[model samples]
Target: MSVTREKILELGENLIRTKGYNAFSYQDISSELGIKNAAVHYYFPSKENLGTSIVKTNIQRFEEMVDNMHSRKFDEWQQLDSFIKIYVKSYREQKKCLVGSLSPDYSTLSDTTKQELKRMIDIILKWLTELLDSGRAKNMFNYNDDPTSKALTIFSSLVASLQLSGIVEKVDYKSFCQSILDDLKP
Candidate 1:
């Protein structure tokens, strides 16, 4: 990506995570990046285009992150902790998960954006499923009644934990993550 394009995408991701997708505009990105609104248009012709681009890039980035984790040879439990950290990174930065941040606005999303969002979510869920499967196989995790449900619950909990932390913030996110990890322990 051109520096300008990358700048817009990075800023756009942060903006969307901080503000809802419907709440941000190219003008917001343009102003923050010290560029003109039309310049933002030059990179992404429409808001949907920009949103879809963010979704696509986020999906790619997340897939690459998981791939990197796999290469590190983390056992299933360790990988699960690392996976929680992936989502926690955003929370620690006071931003939202890329996919979870879109949930409330899902009904309003453009078809293409919605599809990309689903794709991003599916990728994470699939990785979680595989990890859980591995953990079960190794007797490191005992929850196997429904692997997919467990994956979804863990993800949904992490997402909720971040959102809830933003609200009352009564509990630490790391502790929240550990609770999920504990449940998986055999």
Candidate 2:
């Protein structure tokens, strides 16, 4: 991608995560990046196009991260820890994950953006479900609920906690994450 295109994506993603998808405009991106509003339109064509592309790009990066973990032969525990770390990185940056950021605006988003958002969420859920199932079988994680349910619970907790930390005072983000891991400990 050209530097301008890549910068647009980065800024767009940051805006969506920090401010809701509906909160920012092409003007916001254009002003921050010193580009013309038409330039953003040239790359994304429309707000829906930019939103969809942002989610799709995040999904692609996430898949690559998972593949890297698999290649390194990360154990079930290690895999999960790494996954949680993604949220921690977002927390440190004071930004919500793409799913958390876009969910509240789901009703208003274009069909294409909604579809991409759901696909991104499903991808995470599937990975987490498989991780929980495998970990339980290997005695790496201790959880009573079915893998899918547990996956939902864990994913919800992580997203909620990250968003909550942003608004509430004195939230120990790392400890909160560790407690999630603690719940899975045998």
Candidate 3:
């Protein structure tokens, strides 16, 4: 892909992750990229088209990162932290997880875009549950219920922290997440 096109997609992802899919326009991306609206259209054609590509790239990069971590023999605890690290990077960049941020726009999104987002999130859930199960087997994590449920709880808690910070004044998502992770320790 062209460098200009890549810059457009990166900016689009940043915009969607921060402002939301509906909250931004091609003009927003163009202005950020120092390109004209027609240049963005030449690459993406429509907001939906740009959004679809961004989601696909996010999913691909996330899956590949997890796969690489697995191949490197990262233990369950390390894998879990690696997962959290991805969200931390997002929080540092825009103060929200990619999927957690986009989820509010699901109902308004195109069907294909919704499916891609769902797939991306499903991968996160799957990896989390697998890590939780492994941690349980190794007695590294403590939870009375099943790993799947616990995984959802962990994910939901983080999202709530993120949303709360966005809603209330100064909720501190990273500190909240670290506190939860501390409690989850055995």
Candidate 4:
């Protein structure tokens, strides 16, 4: 990506995390970057376009993380713990996951952006589904429900937990997630 586009994505991601999707504007990004509104427009013609780009970038990063987790020489449960650890560490540093920050504002987002968000959610869900399926096959997990649905439930809970952590003051996300992991123990 061009430096300008990367800068815009970074600013937009931060602004969206701090202020929410509907709360920030193109002017907000331009002002923060000390650039003109027209210049911001030159990169992203519309707010929806910028929003879609942000979601796409976040999804790409998430996929990369999942890939890294898979490549690690760990057992399935260990990999899941590693994934949760990555989230907790990122939340400790960034205050919110980029995709989790967008969840609440999804209703007001454009169709394209909403679809992008759904795709990101699906990616996480799919990862969980495969893990659960593999674990069940190996007698590592005892769940009987469809893996996809169960995965969605776990994924949704994690996202909600992260968002709740972001809303609280001086919260220990690692502890919160550890409790979640404890509950999901199998």
Each model's lDDT: 0.86, 0.93, 0.81, 0.80
What TM-score does candidate 3 reach? 0.91
Clashing pairs in 1: none
Q: Which of 2 and 3 is ahead in TM-score?
A: 2
- Top model number, TM-score: 2
TM-score of each: 0.95, 0.98, 0.91, 0.86
CA RMSD for every model? 1.2, 0.7, 1.7, 2.3
Error of 4 at 62 (Å): 1.9
How does residue 51 of candidate 3 score in lDDT? 83
lDDT of model 2 at residue 116? Answer: 89
Quick one: ranking by lDDT, best first?
2, 1, 3, 4
Candidate 1: tens digits of C-alpha lDDT, residues 10-93: 898888888888898888898899999999999899988889999999888888877887798778877788878876787789
In the range 57-172, model 4's lDDT, one tens digit per residue, is: 88888788777876875667886787787677767676566677888887889999999988987787888889888877887766758888878776776777767775678877
lDDT (Cα, 0-100) at 129 in candidate 4:
89
Writing each residue's lDDT as its tens digit, candidate 2 over 91-173 gives 98999988999999999999999998889999999999999999999998999999999999999999898788888998888
Q: What pairs collide in candidate 2? A: none
Regions of candidate 1 where Cα sits further than 4 Å from its true position: none
Candidate number achieving the greatest lDDT relative to the actual structure: 2
